[model samples]
Target: MDASLLREREAFLRRAKALPVVEKPRAVSNAVNDLGPPPTKRIASSVPSDLRSAELRPALQGKFAVLSSVVKYMKQRHLERDTHPLTVEEILEEARLHDTPQSTIRWLEEEVGLIVVTKE
Candidate 1:
């Protein structure tokens, strides 16, 4: 085989691999947004507790700042805890409830107090 022919074949293969054809779906407009009274549902708040439960609805909810403050306070409680040392199971359980490990640790510490911390 000619050396030049082998080189040409390799180049052709590389080109074919690089420029494979693709068929993308076209964007379809349903023509629905302008034909209705808009959505009737309200967004729910994140840190919903009994104290703020009444204010969680869209009609009564405050700004995101208030929600953020509640989250910050929750986190602070976790960090400042001197209770028991957090176990892996307890940590995982807390994480399941709040979707955050830090929040779980704080909550567990709050629940058990001195039991969760170590003496040393």
Candidate 2:
């Protein structure tokens, strides 16, 4: 770190510390602060919770988690069994997503770059 930058940062810290002592603390009100607590009940819900539940939407739920698991499984398999370049089917099976859709699989290939899925 540069000595000038360190001194400037120290000056900034001193200014910040001095603020509380120099000025009288007063309540700064905002809409959220005025509100005591958030409503426990769902206030605006046209969509039901069951429609958004993971049990109903297995393919969309925890996609990043699935990707991470697939990568970890692949790495572990390669380390233990000398496997290379796992197929998407193998990945899906390892992740136990037997009923994952084609579009999501295409996303794993195209958007996430897990593999290149060539058309046969």
Candidate 3:
């Protein structure tokens, strides 16, 4: 080996040996810390009876049929235009243009299995 290269290698070894060792930080238990305390039995027992009695309203069922029709129409329009699949935003915009309620749009996306295209 070259004398300069041998000296540089020795220097590197000396510097490495002089460096202080570091210990890894201990892992923290996140469940309790993140969620805070569990709900007390008294809090659980005090939930209102009216909440338990809540049932789906008949009006909502009709909205599903309307949304399905709108989605069908939107699909046909896309097919006619030879455009890419409708995005959630595009669907919502069409709904808004036709005066469909924001809540109805949300219900269609969340509960009625509306498929949306995401940006690639």
TM-score of each: 0.23, 0.42, 0.35
Clash pairs (backbone) in predicted model 3? none
lDDT of 3 at 116: 70
Q: Which residue pairs show backbone clashes in model 1? A: 78-106, 83-116, 83-117, 84-115, 84-116, 84-117, 85-116, 85-117
lDDT of 3 at 36: 85
**Model 2 agreement with the true structure over 48-118: per-residue lDDT tens digits:** 78775755545766566567767787778878986555678777887677778788777788789887544
The per-residue C-alpha lDDT of model 2 at residue 31 equals: 64
Give candidate 2's whole-model lDDT. 0.75
- The lDDT for every candidate, in the order shown, is 0.52, 0.75, 0.68
- Best candidate, TM-score: 2
Q: On a 0 to 100 scale, what is the lDDT of residue 99 in model 1? A: 34
Which prediction has the highest lDDT against the true structure?
2
The residue-by-residue lDDT of candidate 3 on 4-100, one tens digit each, is 9999999999999999999998677786788888977755646577754332332344576557666676877777885766776676565443445
Clashes of each: 8, 0, 0
Q: On a 0 to 100 scale, what is the lDDT of residue 91 in model 1?
A: 37
List model 1 lDDT by residue over 9-64, tens digit each. 99999999999699998555765754577778987866658758545542243333
